[model samples]
Target chain A: MKFHWFAEVTYGHTTAEEVKNNHTWVDAPATMHDPLKVGKTYQMFIRLMQLADRSNFDGLAVNEHHQTSFAMSPSPNLIAASVAGTTENAAILIIGDSLALYNPPTRIAEEMAYLDCLSEGRVIAGFVYGTPMDSTFCYGVPPVELRDRFREARELILKAWESPEPFAFNGKYNKLRYVNLWPRPVQKPRPPIWVPGSGSVETWDLVIDEDYCYGHLSFSGLRSAKPVVDGFWDYVDQRGGDTNPNRMAFTQICCVAETDEQAEKDYAEAVNYFYSRQNVNPAFAQPPGYRTVKSIAHDIEMRGASSLSNEDRMRAARGEMSFWEYDEKGYIIAGTPERVRQRIRELATDLRIGQLIPTLHMGNLSEELAAKNTQLFGTEVIPYLRDLWADQPDHWTPAVSQQRVNANMPQVAGVAGN
Target chain B: MPLTTQTVDDAQIRVWSAGSGSPLLFLHGFEQHPGDAPFLQRLAQSHSVYAPELPGYGESTGFESIHDIFDMAMRFRRLVEHLGTGPVDVIGHCLGGMIAGEFAATSPHLVRKLVLVDAWGLWIDADQPADPFVLNPEQLKQAKWHDVAAAERETSIAQSHPDGANAAMLLRQQNLGVATKFMWPIADRGLSRRLPYVSTPTLIVHGESDGLIPSAYADEFARLLPNAEVARISGAGHLPQVEREDAFITAVETFLAK
Candidate 1:
């Protein structure tokens, strides 16, 4: 399994009271956020990711969210530029740019290629339709046209990256008289693609058919994700699609310390803050046509009959779940490195997740604690898990960085899948 | 009134028709086809009423083939040419108003007179219309009507069609999902540019208290057209015909009579 250090880059100073007063996404109040603090927050993150690169993390992941105080990153490519320029080994995982929202669409190909050159070819291109709030409401791409726009953008970006000569390209959503890429990506064809989705059948079909990495990037842990993840694997197997676990990526929150008690003491308040501060208005969360009737029907078929109710989700988000309960429910993998390592091993094995994006920093966490968590997770937990999926080859990441990380990997004997 | 289906340009479009006299086309609003609402039934009494739920709306098909607002306008033109026995008087509401304007603009010969009720197509910079998509149900109800209680009297395609268990839900999704093509970012789709070409005399009706698209937008629409009139219905919101049907009818009938 590959270890990627990740964080949402939440505007760390937002208060739970402020979240209670307004939504955390879409039309979340801009007046409540401070620009100085936001810049400081980004600077702090760069330093932390720099540390993560040195600590032997195989990749560092960043994502895009718009008009939300909870997540200040509107452009993952800009953040990737900073990380790619400053860091050496970790893949600059942009999990991703909302494809449909871009004009000309070649902008993504140009920028990702630029980053690839800057980092000597360590970029993972994540194509996403974006969340309903980000794509439909903030960016104003119609929900019905989102998938089509994404499809056109995807085809355009890929062709722009690899096509040697300029060509006339016309699409339903985007039309270009001349298509050419100035600075092509260092990777031969293009950067590896990873697409994240929220259990949409169309997205599953897309990733499966294209053979791109599929990410179930939910903050909710195993208990909530089990059904959807299981459904994905079943669908893949049913379609005779590539069932390589390396093609599957999952995100989890990790809190590690010297001891179990110390871990709890260190992470409890931030954990509660992280889980509790996200308050989205039900209206903003879903709009008409955001999810298709077919996908909604599939969701009902899969989850309508399931055991978990709305209340369990509400409880988890409200910070009502005890720290231990959050752990027990798989919301977070916490405590000593041994415990976290053991839990992640079980999680990766059970879910068949080859790529693990352990979010080391979340809500209101001090920079100091996040650094310690990232370092500890990289050094103590990662080396042990290499033997789990070591047999399988990962095609999702750039070879150069993979080789770099492996070259410096700590040669620990007792920690191999024990 | 009987719900029927018609084929236009190889696409199946579900239509609702009733009454008889001169050919009159009724285009329903953004949220849905009003089905056999009292207002539509009233309109039917004066003329032959042919209200086709736009393609991809309700049991209507061919949404996948539509690429943009121009394709949408062309589809409406084709549908009108297929359905109308003679040049028709057109009444459009909300999202349907935007489509109806485009139809009249594209094929003026197919339209005699046009009525736009609380329509969307113009954007006012200082007094921007409230985003209809973002409003919650309660906010939507309030934005759509001066008196919230009036929503109970409104009927939708869901109420009219009971073919399957989840038919109502799915049909509504299809209807609104199709609407996003024109209304998603902003309701304006360069219709203002085409409005000048519509030589047919038009009437713009606005609910005085419409929170969604303020009466200022009606004024803007009137200014852009070749010949147009504005009627501000008092004590009404977005749907003037639904809120104050008697005045709405009186104003529309008087104008069309001229």
Candidate 2:
């Protein structure tokens, strides 16, 4: 099982001018080093990795974004490369390189291959179609076409990685006359592939069909994510696929300290920095046009799906809407190490998920606070979860392995086959 | 210098200013705080505009106790008196306009000229009910009981620049939580009557599609004031400064120039 600590590299500003006008945009370093260079941004990822290493975490995670102060790792592969050298043991997981956002999937495949080699086989690659508001506008791609393009991109990359030699393929988004990938991954076949989603039903089916790790990024709230995950499991059950709990993972914020009170106090500040400043941007979330039809439909379904009264919806929306304060019931967990462990166990059992990706370092959280939380979780919470569910063999594994293989797979002749 | 902040008792009150000219105090919308940015900087270039964080809004020191818009206006008047060294031109946006209107009505001697930008005052027929876009069901239900406090806020910045990036930033800066709390069924229906007592030169600029406080209401506001000029900024909403910044600015600049 691979464990990862996710960092968004978030910052809160009163206006965009503060970001655009500031000198730190160019002067600041992406990697953490000197205090004078602490860009509130690079500091976020640096803190995450440092904590991941200190806590014996399997990997440290970072992501990509454009034209926003959100987890500013525009080129996540760069951060992945930095993490490759920064930490020795922890696998550097780039929770995404938007395949659709990039013009050619080969760029992503080649980069992941290089990153796999760089990490010495410790690379967990994540693919995602861009979200509305950010990636859609940045790439100038119409939202309607994103899903088809994404699928085409994924197929191309998979062929590039798994195929023996250069091949040719044709699709709506890309056409390759010669398909050749250099420096194939260190791991046989390929490094573990994880697709991050926000409840796209089609994505769930695809993940299950391909036997790839399915990750649900519960950025909104746990209750909000129920229908989405339920949909994923339903698809798995329908296919008669052996449901490996480890096949499912959830990304949520978790902070643990010596005491519940201390954890709450420290977590509140970071939470405030996130909800109050960063995520509150209406532009960050307008309407879904970036993912597959199922994901977009799921989001649309949830628009009026929850039975919460309009007043409650408004409250929930307002509660979860800001970039300044903590959403008490949203995607975060803040408590003592013991309490955190129990909550994780309950969530895992209730959500029926196997692996858990906790975002411990978030929203301007200090290095000290992040490191302490990591260390405490490693020492206390992890053991408690393992001990509490000691009887369940299914709960024991890191990453669940599937026994079935795609037998009699067709040969990829050329662009015509795609 | 443009927008600046000063921490008062843990809360930070941001202030915006421009050229070392006559003071034109510009108060932002209901949920916003003053900050260093292009919008404030541009305003500062013409008149020495002073935009401050209202009590209980933004980073400003929140009200020590529960208070209404009138109570806030009283505090704002005090803040202006304390901050201004000489006669000043006063301006307000949305609820800020109401506060500025009330302030000018009450303390006519302190202000030389008054510019109310889509200010909220006077109980318009109540016939229209409230704007749906501004307040959702949660606010209406919660408003029934004063016990349930409104949520904390981060104001969404308005981006009017040609580049889509500013628009994108504007979307991110939106803090509906603050707006929910700052907004309430307004009281103080006497603003229309009090307008006759406002002795200062006044400019009333409004958006054509201001559903919350319609353009008709802006006209009525101007009609009541003995010394007033009324103008409509086309293709704008309640947030005319954002939707029609060029026209909004031109009206104010022309009024102030006169």
Candidate 3:
């Protein structure tokens, strides 16, 4: 199994009262945060990711969101560049740049190529149709046109990366007379592309058809994700698509410590802070045409049979659940190395997930605690889990970083290291 | 009133038609078509009223071919020609008002007279309009009617249909989704620039209390049109035709008579 160190880059200074009083996304008041503090937070993330690199995580994942204290990452490429230039072993997994938000998508082509060259081919390109709040509300792209714009941009970028010479391109959304990318990618046919989605069948078909790695990047834990992930695999298998576990990625919020009591003590408040601060106004969550009629029907049907009840989800989000309740329902995996390892192994084996993007840091977590969590998971947990899916070849991540991470992994007690 | 499917540009569209005299094309607002409303029935008494559900709206089939407002205008032109009508009077409301403005400007030869009621086609920076899509039911009620209590009587999307409530919701979503093509963010699709080119005599009617679109926009639309005048309906908000039916009908009929 491949592990990626990921975090939401949440602003750490927000108080519980402040979180309760306001919605955390799209129109969240900016006055609640200090710019200098945000800068310090960025520096803190860079440091934590650097530590993750040294500790032998396979990839460092970053993503883009807009107008949200929940993430605070507007341009993930900037963060990706910081990690790419600094880290030597981990893939700079930009879990993505919102393709439709960028005009003349050659900009994405050029930037991804620059990162690939900078990391010496340690870049994984991720293309996404950003959240409705980000694309339709914040960036002002019409929701109806978002998917079309993303597909056009993707086609343009791929052609720009592969075309040997400058070419004239005519597209409905963009028209460039001369299309040429100066800094071509280090990977022969550009970097491995990953597309993260929220269980839309259209997305499943897209990833399966294009052979791109599909990531179910929700922090709602295993119970929330199982139905959708299982449905995805079923859809893939029925279509006769590749059933390799390596093509799937899942996100989980994780907290690890010396003992289970220590884990609860250190992470409870922060986990509560994480869940409570993500109260998006329901109106902005799903705009018209954001999800198709078929997808909406499918979601309604799937959600009706889900293990996580509406009350459970609400309680989890409102931080009303106990720390163990959160863990029991799979909103998180928190405990000592042994318990975390057991739960994660069950999660990966049951879901058949090869790429696990573990969120080690969450809301209001201290820099020191997050670093320790990253260190513990990297040193103790990852080494033991490497053998779970070693037989399945992973073509999702860049080749050089995979080899480097495998070569540099630390030897665990009684287990043969990768 | 009768509902029929008409073939235009190799795509089928649902159209509602009734009455006699000269042809008049009635375009409904952003919500669903105010199906067989009293105002529509009254208008059909004096003029041959043809109200087609816009492509991709309701059961209409041609939304995929419409790339922009120009394409939408062309689709309307094809529909009009297929009806064997020459240069008909056009009345458009809300989102339909925006499309009607585009149609009048682009196909000046086809529209004899134009009426835009609580239209959305211009963006005035200082008097920015409220976003219609984001408003909740209560907020929308407050924004769309001068008398909030009267909003419960509004029948824009509540008309009885063969389909159940779930299908109705789906239809509502589908209609609003198509509206986002021109109305998302700000409703301005450079209609202010094209308004001057519209040779058809135009009447810019607005609800005095429209929170979705302020009265200043109607003034701006009149200011931009080559031949136009403004009529304000009191005790109304976004849907003046429903709020002050008699006044709206009088204003439209008087303007069309001229």
Report each candidate's C-alpha RMSD, comma-separated, in the order given: 2.0, 20.9, 1.9
For model 2, residues A238-265, the per-residue Cα lDDT tens digits are 9886577767768878878777677767
Q: Rank the candidates by lDDT, best first.
A: 3, 1, 2
lDDT for B118 (candidate 3):
94
**Measured by TM-score, how close is model 3 to the native structure?**
0.97
Worst 10 residues of 3 chain A by lDDT: A409-418
Please compute DockQ, using alpha carbons, for every candidate against the native two-chain complex: 0.69, 0.01, 0.69
Docking class of 3: medium
Clashes counted in candidate 3 amount to 0
Which is better, 2 or 3, measured by lDDT?
Answer: 3
- Tell me, by TM-score, which candidate is best: 3
Q: For candidate 1, lDDT tens digit of each residue in A317-381?
A: 99999888888888999998888989999899889999999999988899999999998999988
Question: Could you tell me how far off, in angstroms, the CA of residue B211 lies in candidate 1 after the best superposition?
Answer: 3.2
